[model samples]
Target: MFKEWARSVRYASKFHRKQEIVTFMRQIDDLEIYANLSKFLCDNYRQALKILKSEPELKRWMSVEGIDDYDTFHVWLEEEREYLMGMEDGLPKKREETVEMEYVKRLKNLESSQGRLSSILKAERAALSDRADFNPAPISQVACRHAVEHRNRDAELVQDLEVRLGITQQWTSESPEWILAEKSIMDHRYLDALDEIERIIVERLFEMTKIHQSGTRYKMRRHIAKALQARSKAIRNAIDRYNTVAEEMDPPKPTLSWEEVVNYGFLAEFDILRDTGDSIRSRPWTRRSYRVAMDRYFKILRAKEEIQRLNIEIKRVVTWIEDEDWFLRRKEAEYKDLNPPLAVQISRYRQRRARSDYNHMQRFWALAKTPGFTGSVVPGVSVERQQARHAERASRPQTSREMEMEVVDERERWNSSQEGEWEDDDDEGEEAEQEKVSTLMYQMSVLAVDQDDGRTHQLD
Candidate 1:
């Protein structure tokens, strides 16, 4: 019996301790604190949504809980507050001993309801915080915007260059060099296409340089170079913008580390006794602030990607230009070395040969017009003998094999005659004949050079 009495006393002591703990919890009004926090979270979420709605571009970046949940929680909080106010109003005007137990029971039920509501509020706040922390939609939206802007800017710069070059026709296909290069590519002559493009670029550079030297108004190279400079400036501007946004959006670090905030309460264990600390104190950012920061961060990433691509493209073109410039300089030096003296000789030779040909033609015509003329117009040849020889040769009948052999012999004789023509000339005439041969060679070279120049001008 004494042991049973001792066990009852132990149970009574435990029950009293639990009652004191409950009373202390109720006095702190943790239920009200949780409700206020939930309301604060709801307000922030609503404000963020409003801002997102105003900016359609930014709307795609927000990922959060639905408004209906917040609405429901708010309605419940309001109803519970009204019920508590009504209960306070209905409290007896005079403290009646007979109604004390009833009042106590009603108060206990209200406390229980408050406890349940506080738990619900705490759960809601946790959900909202988790959503705010983890969403990446804002970052994705910023990155997409950055990439789009960069692409548009690049296109605009390219269009401007095209306009300035007067090659703005659709696809810029009207440029003869481009057309030839494109045709070569279509023909599966990749090396030819590359050569054509390189040649055109070198020619343009050379022409521009010549124009500059002559103090002319040629601006094609200047425009192209300007566009390249703009591209470089755009890259720098993008990088600067990215850096500025990053600095602007970067939030100050929280006083407490994440580990500390999670492991210990806002005020450590003291928060439990005081019950006045807020969970939000541990976090540095709200949902909207965090999202905006992430957006800027992602924008920086996209800018970096675009900058890298631009750098590669610009570097490739610049390298090609440098190589073409070197090639152009070398070719110009070669042309200067070989053309001037040779061209002067060829020109003088052509004038003399033309006069000689005219005189020979006039003499031949005059001799033909003479009534009794029988001699060949050509020097050292008899016309009658030449005609008789041709007639005898034509009259001779021969088998196909003999005919073929005769044709071969004729070719050999013609070749030998041409080879001995200069050798048969007297020493006094030898130098003149050699000059004629050299003039013929120079004519062929001039014709080829003229054709190439014509083609190059057509390309221009």
Candidate 2:
């Protein structure tokens, strides 16, 4: 009966059928039957340990668990048995021992994979931040999101100017300055016309700023400043229209900052537009309009030449950013989806270690039952390994038949060799037999003549 149960347990453990093993054990009622099986299990445990002791990894495991001596090993066997029982009852405790280097290696690989993913995500974020077009501004200022809005407004103003220039609408009225500006643009005298407008605005602004005013002079200056402001606004509107069409046809592109281009030639004359908040000395609105017009003029000039180049640069940056964004997202997804194979490794190690521990327990119980059995009992031989070694030795080729086959194989191999001198005597047998007849004729001549006679005959 015990033999039958032992066979079932062996089959169950061998095939990883844990439930089946439990089912077989549960069918037993007799305490003696359990005892007998337990003894057998102990014997098997000792057998397995003896076989595994020679393996370096298993030896390291023994050292790690402090199972060096038989007494300590026996104590460990008891603990393992209880742990296995606990697993069968309800709660399964996972083995957290770092004894297996393979488990550690798997953990390291998972970390490395995740680390690479982090690097990709970080690079993508950096690329996103590097975009010059994505500017966010304060309550008082402009932002990147407003670029299209500003562009559209500029385009509409340009369209309005085009309608006025062509007199496309029946009810449209044209100002003389606007008409003159339009004619200059058509005639390709853009520089002359633009300069003339800029000169008129600048002269008026210079006069207003230079005026040293008492009460009457101040009043007169204020009136003149009001007229200058109105004129500057009208000229700026025309320039804005011209700039809009110029930008749409060939837009100006800036790689870093357009503020430099906008602020460059206007900085010194721009002080009049600064808000000093001093009511007594507040600069007129006309001065502000002139300054803005000057800035617009510079922007239009710069755009007329470099719009396409700036567009190409912006496109390149935006495209690179988009590519990086996609790559980063892909890496992030991979990271999120990362499921390390460490679980599988852990399962495998647990299965093997459980097998080893169970066998050790069975051996300890067997030793306990034996009369006068001491903890000093040590396995002198690994029966399973010895059998395996014998099996391996038996499978190897040997003796006369094998040697003859090897010789035939060698002959086949040697037949392909080009060098004649490397051939063995057996291989050169025909050549040696052919050379024997020539050697025999030479020997007969030597025997027929004395040493001196042979020498003299050879010389003649």
Candidate models: Cα lDDT each: 0.39, 0.40
Local distance difference test, candidate 2: 0.40
Each candidate's number of clashing pairs is: 0, 7
lDDT by residue for model 2 over 339-400, one digit each (tens)? Answer: 32443343333333334333333344344333322121111223443464356459974544
- Model 1 residue 295 CA deviation in Å: 5.6
RMSD vs true structure, all candidates = 47.1, 44.2
Please list all clashing residue pairs in model 2, or write none if there are none: 42-362, 42-363, 45-359, 229-286, 251-307, 252-307, 253-310
Task: Write down the RMSD of candidate 2 (Cα, Å).
Answer: 44.2
The C-alpha TM-scores of every prediction are 0.14, 0.15
What TM-score does candidate 1 get on C-alpha atoms? 0.14
Question: Using TM-score as the measure, which candidate wins?
Answer: 2
* Model 2 Cα shift for residue 42 (angstroms): 99
